[model samples]
Target: MCQRCEEPERPEEERYLIEVLDQIRENGWCVQGVLGTGSRPSWAYTAGLTAQGLPELVVTGLLPHHAARLLNAAAEQTLHTGPPVPGEQWLLPRLPKLEIVQLSAPAAHLHIAVCCYGAGIEARQLVYADSAGRFPWSPQYNSGRGGQPVLGVRHA
Candidate 1:
């Protein structure tokens, strides 16, 4: 969503945070979500990528702990049935020095505002398991969506 479309509607604090994130990204900083330390790691899937090639990490309708482990190698998290679970992580590996920002709106349980840092391994953040099928990637979504390049579709 564009800043104008999603920003003004946000609460004051949230609006401010979005603005800051905009600035940070503008300054060439990369921001993405990460799993929290000490908390139990949750199940996640990397469904696909945006038209821009950003990976869509889905994290819902997921199998339980054991089931998830058995299927951990899969990228598509949910079956095409069931209620949609909304959670996701937008990875920006193109830009290094990654970090996570927990907006007032909860992001699949991972959070922000602390500036916590350490360890060399990248943190595993998450997003909606259902969102794996969202626009820019899913062919069904590419139809008539006029924002980003609909990868497989040709312009008239």
Candidate 2:
């Protein structure tokens, strides 16, 4: 099931998120769905990463209250699953100061624009305005039917 839509799509972002999460598991972290549609929302699994890793939810096109509810649900589920792997130790000890911009074309809006630094603590300032152009990260998204690796190291 999709976090945005109740029914799943052919090429669902949730699946991609899961795949990336699996990669994280092999490399340095673990990811599981935290919130979505259904009797048992999909996000029950990801609560453990909040302490040890960067566990977050992307809530687009939802009201502030609804988003809060989803977040709370995710937290409760996380607590139910188990505590973080390394307790208070974070995966990315030296997190970079970064900003994220999300564009909603039809609305001509830049619905989400925020900046944050460090691990787990994000100071968000959501801006609502028409976007000037495609966001910087847009180029990183592959339009291919097959979800190929964006960057792969070649052996000599």
Candidate 3:
């Protein structure tokens, strides 16, 4: 029998961890998405950047593919230019200016990152603006139910 057959099967979590590590090794980061409940908006986050001494990223109220694209772009930028600090505004080509806010409760929101990198993992939420260029914090901005949820307190 092959040496591979000698050992017992690994648990799902272990297998998942291996896969995530593989992705990180290949791509510098891995994106994970969480489906929303009726009361929560869908969200996605990067999981591997923190290992590179970069803050992981999160975005809410977008479809999985959209969120992944945004995160991937941001991750690429961050890798080349270093991570953005909380309260900084980042402008990506063809996208509205994004506000970077440090997550107050990363452990509560970034379950996947916490599982992979533990509770100490740092994360920043990329807060997108509306079509009218109004951010969620703006009193005049219109956000329907389950719209973008800011995972942290807005910086002054």
Best by TM-score: 3
lDDT for model 2 comes to 0.29
- Least well predicted 10-residue stretch by lDDT in candidate 2: 106-115
**Which regions of candidate 2 are displaced past 4 Å?**
1-49, 52-54, 82-156
For model 3 the local lDDT of residue 103 reads 93
Ranking by TM-score: 3, 2, 1
Cα lDDT of model 1 by residue, 1-156, tens digit: 666676667677566456645543453222232342333333332221221122322232223552233223222222222212223333322211111222222233223222211111122223221233454334554243422221112111
Q: Name model 1 segments beyond 4 Å from true.
A: 1-13, 24-29, 33-38, 41-53, 56-156
In angstroms, how far off is 9's CA in candidate 2? 51
- lDDT against the true structure, per candidate, is 0.30, 0.29, 0.86
TM-score, candidate 3, is 0.89
Task: For candidate 2, write residues 45-137 as lDDT tens digits.
Answer: 222233343333332323445444544443444345533221122121122111222212211111111111123232111111113322123
The per-residue C-alpha lDDT of model 3 at residue 78 equals: 94
Which sections of candidate 3 miss by over 4 Å? 1-8, 143-146
TM-score of each: 0.20, 0.24, 0.89
Q: In candidate 3, which residue pairs clash?
A: none
Displacement of the residue 25 alpha carbon in candidate 3, Å = 0.8
